[model samples]
Target: MDLLSLDFLILAGVMLAAGAATGVLAGVFGVGGGALMVPVLFEVFGLLGVADQVRMQLAVGTSLAIIIPTSVRSYLGHRARGAVDMTLLRNWAVPIVLGVVLGAGIARFAPPSVFMGVFVFVAGVNAIKLISGTRRWDIASDLPGGLLLRAYGGVIGLLSSLIGIGGGQVANIIMTLHGRAIHQAVATSAGIGVLISIPGTFGYILAGLGQPGLPVDALGYVSLMGVMLFVPTTVLTANLGVRLAHALSRRSLEMAFGVFLAIVSVRFLYAMFAG
Candidate 1:
């Protein structure tokens, strides 16, 4: 949280760039940067000698806290592009909202290390699937797809509740593999991320009360300072990424982001197992 010297300024600049790139990738892929952001935050928190128990929480909580504003603006940007399915959102939102609240409440009481392990493992599986070109996009029909969508949202809510990120990866992977157009999937996924993050962020915040030895500048495990610094740049960058997607091939971007997530997942799992 200190910005007293040139070193702090340099770190801040790096983090800012990270935040912006994070959002761009999120918008481009509907990932909300969790795959990258948590690692970045954990590395930073580790450098700061943040306690072991609280480090992952700090990473998770801080990322979610940052996404609140960023996702709102990003969602609106996508909505403007006709990428979002507002009707679809209305259908999915009700169950997702309820599920998110339940998930957050669980995170508030769950064990942090166990939570981090699960997050790392799931990300690893998803990343591996992407890297191996083994992803499937098949869906039965509207009824099955709707059920699948609800399930994705539910799982995303639960995961995001614990990890403090937008649930875009889950939504993105599911929808894209199920034959949703990439642009629409990414846009709709961002909206889903926004929906889940709003509750998940606060859930992580409240959950931090279950562990009091977190960092100084945090609300629960999330750094309020990190959120304040990140949200603005991320919002702008997400919009930029959306614009770039329009001018570029979305399949290419998905492959790229998928590769990136795989790398990140490997790193996260390595750290988790190493620890």
Candidate 2:
């Protein structure tokens, strides 16, 4: 395809717009923007003539690659406001990395449906709880001790890696359900994104190595071109999201996050059952 073609320009514009939205979502919801980027990349990759066999993997890998910078920027913004939980991040770090490694291994062999199933189940449950706006949804007054919390972190990392997320959605849901404030949960989630995205990106590159059907400009499953198109806009807009998140009321933030999760769940559900 010609670089100056109308189709190329349209796709470029779409990527920039998606990057902007992704940055906002990362800030407001404390996610790595994968929930939005994965779907967008899938469609964009398809339109660009990527084979069906590798399209989903390419989307996921590219999303993770893009999340690295965006998550870092968002995390720093949250940290500046003193919203981040350093102790929690430290405690969860090892288990999360281990989980990401396991998930990356699984990705090398798993089918696309496996990821869709995980995404739907996780996002759907959290969406229902937060959207209902009931105190009864609170599972405990505080997070579980030691091994249990570590296990949760592992699971969060595993799922996030498979689905190409920042692990924020999983962390935020757990934190909020255990009585943590929405702002704190959101801030902490940004840190989780940082942990997940770095290893996740490399894992994907390793996973996709030597795989057939990968497109041009791909290093394994990651599309370097896609990363180039997304990074600048995503990084520039992430701080804006942080400011908006801090400005919102606790209840308002929860509602917003819940709605975002609901949309993610629905999108995957449709793909699994209808597409």
Candidate 3:
């Protein structure tokens, strides 16, 4: 695809709009915008005639790059309200980063079909959990500590990196189930995005370094154009999402997020089967 072409400019505009929406969702749901951005990026890259072999990798990597800034915006917004759990964020950082490195390595070698399948499955399960409004289940009194905490962080980081997310969904689930307030969980999840995206971004870059069929202005599999066009809008809208999150009731937020996840899941499933 011609980076200078009219079509590319139009697509870049679309990406900007998507990034704004993603930022709001990231702040509101603590999803880090990856769940929303990855699929859209994949489609955009496909439209640009990116090779199938590297297209999903590019999408995932670029989505992570965008998250680097968006998540920071979200964290700041949530922190200002005193909703963030700094202790949890501090404890989870190391393991999550390690997991991101592992996940990025796997993503580099795995086929697009495998990644798509994993995304569809995880998103579907999370959507069902959100829709059901089941908060009674509790296996622990609080967030795990010591080795268990590290393991949990590792799993969240691994799955999040593989799917190009900020690890918010899984982190929220863990925190909520362990008796954390919904607001705190959502706030802390933004920090988790920082932990995951930093390592995941570089990992993808190293993994895809010297690879063929990448789009123009790419750093490894990450698209510079996508990052440039997306980050600003995300930064602008993330605070709005934080405001909305504070305003809404927990049940309302859960239901809305559930619907969003369902839509994402359905889209992935359709792509998987129809493509």
The number of clashing residue pairs in each candidate reads 2, 0, 0
- Native-to-model Cα distance after best TM-score fit, residue 35 in candidate 2, in Å: 0.5
Candidate 3 lands at a TM-score of: 0.91
| Tens digit per residue, CA lDDT, model 2, 118-221 | 76786687788777878787889989889999998999889899888899888988898898998999999999999999999999999999999998799998
The lDDT values for all models are 0.71, 0.90, 0.85
User: Model 2: which ten-residue window has the lowest total lDDT?
Assistant: 107-116
Residue 108 of candidate 1: its Cα lDDT? 45
User: Which pairs of residues collide in candidate 2?
Assistant: none
TM-score of 1: 0.84
Ranking by lDDT: 2, 3, 1
Kindly report which residue stretches of model 3 are placed more than 4 angstroms away from their true locations once superposed: 1-5, 111-126
| Candidate 3 lDDT score at position 142 | 85
lDDT of 2: 0.90
What would the TM-scores of all predictions be? 0.84, 0.96, 0.91
State the displacement of the C-alpha of residue 239, model 3, in Å, after optimal TM-score superposition.
Answer: 0.6
For TM-score, the strongest prediction is 2
